[model samples]
Target chain A: MIEFIPVLLVIFTGFSGIMINRNIVMKLISLDIMNTGMVCFFVLISKMSGSFPPIIHSLDEMNLDFVDPIPQAVIVTAIVIGFSTLSLSIALTAMVIERTKKVKVDDIEKKVGT
Target chain B: MFLVLNFVYLFILFLLVLLRRLENLQIFFFVSFMFFLPFMKNMDEIFEGIGGVHIVFDDTSRLFVLMNVLVFLGVSLKMRGKKKIRFPFVLTFITLNFLYASADLFNIYVLLELLSLETMILISSGGKVKQFWSSVKYMIFGSVGMNIYLLGVGMVYMQNGTFDLTKILRVSNVSLVLIFTGLLVRTGFFLYGMWLPSAHSSAESEISAILSGVIVKGGIFSILRILSFEPFSSITPWITKVSAISSFLAVIFAITSKSFKRMLANHTLSQLGFIMSNVETAPMYAFAHALFKSWLFILADELPSERFDEMGKRLNLFPWIFLILGSFSIIGIPGTIGYAAKSSLFKNTYNFERFFLILASIGTSVSFSKLISRRPKISGWGGIKENLHNLYFSILVIGGGVVLFEFRMKSFIQSFLLFIVGFLLHRMIGKNLKELRNPLERIEVNLFVISTLILGMILWLIS
Candidate 1:
């Protein structure tokens, strides 16, 4: 659906950021954005199947359609995993900076002589 | 009950992380084995895995768990006085646990990424420039492989509407080529894993042990999972042939490699190819190789350079027990663990495939011969404590292999003659063999493309 276009755009932008950016931190941020965009895309697709959250309530006997909960569960797990990945990436980046004291990928490469 | 135990172990790991106590990492691994014990209560649960929930304890997985626990205990004992080892060590352990527990395709991907990230961190921690470049190369290759796999997943999801391998296994041929190719890339088939030697061998010895031992095994696990559950009915012939051809070429390449660690890395690739060729036997062989090879890499890494001369001197003093046991296990010597897997493979594969296995085994023996020939000479001054620890770890691994072989004695015995023949052939050619120039030189663009094409064509023909 057209509603998914923005998510797609975000994902595209993330990919481009990674490709074009020479700074390692910028590239890592792009990876984060790409992961977030993926989670959003999954959520948006799940939303297409229903109009409301999947939570059940005993007080309401009315017909309250609910979206598929599977993708939502998967996305939540993915998000947690993404956070761990982000932390690890930042840790690695810090290590790199500590050693080379440069955040630019090209500069590090030059310093290390390929 | 098994699920609860798994959750409990994970919770314990979480607490260890929160407390920031690194020694608890070994305790956590020990607890994981304790957890696995209850799961083994119902023998039926052994076969039941993550997705398929099948009724068998996958002999291979059991072996891997045992090996992992044993080596980890040995390493942990040697790890005293090392500060700030908690985070990286615990993270790696958690990732390995997750990898072992995962059943679904996407779960494997997530775990693999975690493993890779942890590996990069561990490698770069040494502050070596070469290590950084190798890690960068590893990341690039890994990302490219992951993206290709993601595209395949997209195609699979579109076709089958599910990512659960159990469900995917029920469907056939809809996206077979895509699935296989994706998995091939992920498993480091042929030239695709060119970065493996650099990344795996360049790291510190302990890091190398984990990378070569656990990380690459994760890829092999996924490949085995796909082969086992997926509807390979349509592509069996093609898969079999391609596996045979690729595995043969890998063995040849491994035989030609030098540098102790680099040769071992190539051997990992070649051995993986051999395991993949006999799909029926792959699950167990893959599991056993991961267990044994990981330990071997650790042992090889821990060989003290300072005591190299002492080790060489005392090498003959200690009974040839460890070397004989370890070599026999790897070369499928009779009454060793490798024989059990080899027998199963030979029994299931066709004559042509059997011939390939024979040649591959010979290549392995030849490569390892090169390894043994370069053993560092030991001096008399090496400390008793360090030597004792080394002896204990080496014996433990060798003993584990022996126990595995005994457990599968009948199958192992059947492969005895084949192994002896292979070993003799290796001894003959290995002695006369001249070392090639560093295989790194062949990584040039033109040679890379040519090799890839040649390998691909051979695969096509064999398939």
Candidate 2:
């Protein structure tokens, strides 16, 4: 139950961060936090049946105690994609900063709105 | 065996990417050949039970695939000058093919992600720094939508122990709501659709054509695929009602658009709202929209600036005729495929739905009538000999109009009345046209995603 608290807290904080922040970079960070929260929840759910890493070198070593491999695999892909998305967003933010020297959402909107 | 054709196309696209010196005509022929290959497929040749990668050749997917080919062909023809966009464009085409072919839930997710990535590349390839922001926003919205979708996938996997859509025995209401909400954002439905016009209209016109015509439909297709299991039949009315309301919002927003391309982009969302509510006629309308909307975009590209109601005045004779035809088809003149798609909706629905659909049609007609109202300036422009691509597209649009017409004689009278009503509405509203053109400001990506999620949850609760 406590583990679930962190998940809910992280997700809620992520949402609040996005809502409260006007800076583009800060929003990107909040997006990352939200993504992390989701990944963490998936990993938490996979812990229900077992806790060991989902790996086996020998057929005899395979048992019911082994962790579920699917969510882990899926999370890895999600993390890598999340990393790419974050970096690309940062690069775009840097470009926006270079052009107008403003990273706040309202400032950017004012400059580009016409 | 036809399933392997997508891989083969991908392999060829990969080779072309590496080689980087292939002629454009060869690529066009290759695309044409692959487009025709699906027609050769037997309906029962579905490949399943192979490591969770199932590919089914159903009627709806077939229609979408053909529409994909048609728009792609037009884009290729228009892009004869720019050889660089071919790589990402072909990559997008391959992902779309696989997206349509995919039968499982996870496969759809993966393919959709890949398609978004390819589209991101395509959008940024325009090289304007402004385009970079739009491209990034598209990525942000797309990834968030997919991640939310992944949560629903996880729930379904936990409950059913399988990712294969065909093998899944049941879907809980929570899972249905999650999946539907995620896809709602992806499909650019009403509150979630703020990002669509920016990403779609800001790109180059050819890219805009594909984005409007094909990419957004990926979300609609996935939603349809999920509901095909018939596990949550009770959710149908909710989806239809939401889509209808969204469609009305789309048109109202579209009427406020200031530019031709942006107006078309908003109309794409509005038309999607129509397509979403009418599942049986979705493929037909998707095809109809791909043909006419892309033709309209390609024609709009020939003009310098894309200001609303301006291009109609200066367009040459070749584009003038084609533009009129395209707008007519979109407005559902009795002889075109749009008539078939639109009238079918009105035919099967009940009293309110029929009235709602007719009102939507009137909105469509009024909007498109704005497109064709300007008097054509005849002189000083070159003839049909100079612009062969426009001529070719015109032929295809006309041929498609003829082959796909499904007009009933009675509905033809109804369509006439709708046209007159729409014209009268247009006159009454014409004086306010300047104020009606709404230029939407760019919403922050993270806030947009969060709000969309909350809206989805509200929809889930009510439904």
Candidate 3:
């Protein structure tokens, strides 16, 4: 139960960080944090069954105590997607900053017509 | 076998693009080939048991896929000049195919991430500062929505040991709330669509059309797919409310905005509201919207500055005629597809929701009054001869509605009367209408996320 609290705390912390930040890079970091928290939550749930990795040495010897591999595989995929998304967004922000010389949302907001 | 065949269809397009430069003729042939592919598909087929994921090809997805291809053909016709956009445009087109076919929640997430990422690349491909900022906002919104969606997927998986959508039953309602809230952001509901007017209006017209017409439908399709199950059908009415609210708010914004493209983007939300409020008839409405909305965007691409004050006096002969036709179809004149689609959607709903939808329909006309009331200048300053291909949409909107669906005589007069009222109302308030401080003009992530949370909490209390 306490371990679950840390996951929830991390998730909400990132969520709040996203809601409060006006800087674009900070928002991106918050988004990454939230993503990491969700991934960790998935990992925690998959680990509830066992701490052992989802590895089976022999085809016939099936280890029942091993954690579910599917969710782990899913997180691995999620991590890859998250990484790509983060990098692309960072590159996009870098381009924006390079062009406008504005990093804060307020300064940027006045430039774009409402 | 079917999945492999689908990949093969896209792969051939990929090869054609990668092998050499593709001309307009090559693109036309590719569009026609993919357009014919859906007719060959086996209906109601399920491809399962390979993994825990559920994948199905039913009538709804099949029809959506066909409509997307038809829209693609229309878009590709206009996609002549920009050789760079055509590649991402085609790739995003293929991603949409996979998105529509996805039945599992995880597949939807992955595909949505991919679809929006490709769209981000397309939007910022102009390499302009403004486009980059808007695309970054799109990227941020996409990642946030997908992450929340992931949380819901995790919870669902935790409760029911599998990700197969068909197998998940008796799941808690919180999961539904999380899922709905997350997907609504992607779908551009009232709170989250604040990013839409900027993002949609900023992207190139072709990309805007795709974003507005088809891509957002990816999330709506997922919501409808999830709501199709028996245990979760209870949440349908709330979706109706949410979409109704979104359309109404969007209409309010569109009516006041002076920018031509921004108003059109807002109306995309309104029409999407029309689609979402009535799920049973969504496919037909989605198809109709994809055609005409893309039609308008393609025409918008030809114009210089997208301002309403200048639009009437500046448009050439080709765009003026199509603009009037698109507006008529959008306002649901008696013989157009908009009339048929709106009539059916309104018929299947009732009570306050029906009233809300009716108000939204009237609001649609009122917003479109800016376009409808414009008297075209006869002298063509510029000949828009390059866009002869848009004739396809013109023919469909003009005659397809009556032939495709039984033109309801009962509501014909009602819609006409609604249009008159809307027109008169616009005329009365038209002079006074000024651009309101649109909360959506800037990317307000803080406000959007806060409202989403509040909505989630309210939904939690309700459930």
Best by lDDT: 3
TM-score of chain B of each: 0.79, 0.91, 0.93
Best by DockQ: 3
- Model 3 gets an lDDT of 0.78
Candidate 3, residues B1-463: lDDT per residue as tens digits? 5566777867886777766555563365456566558555675767775446778888888877877777777677666677777667778878888887778878888888888788889888777777888888877777777777788788888888888788888666677777777787777776664667778888888788888878877777888888888766887888887777777877988899888888898888787788888889888888888878888887787665688776544456667778888988888887788888878877788886787887887888898887777666665544345655567778878767868666567788888988999999999998688787665545565445545664666577576
Q: What lDDT does the true structure give each of the candidates?
A: 0.60, 0.72, 0.78
Q: Please give, for residues B39-86, the per-residue lDDT of candidate 2 as tens digits.
A: 645574477764355777787677677777767876677777687787
Model with the higher lDDT, candidate 1 or 3: 3
| CA displacement after TM-score superposition, residue B458 of candidate 2 (Å) | 5.5
Report the C-alpha displacement of residue B187, candidate 1, in angstroms.
3.7
- TM-score of every candidate: 0.73, 0.92, 0.94
Evaluated at residue B186, the lDDT of candidate 3 is 73
Candidate 2 total steric clashes: 3
What is the lDDT for B396 in model 2?
70
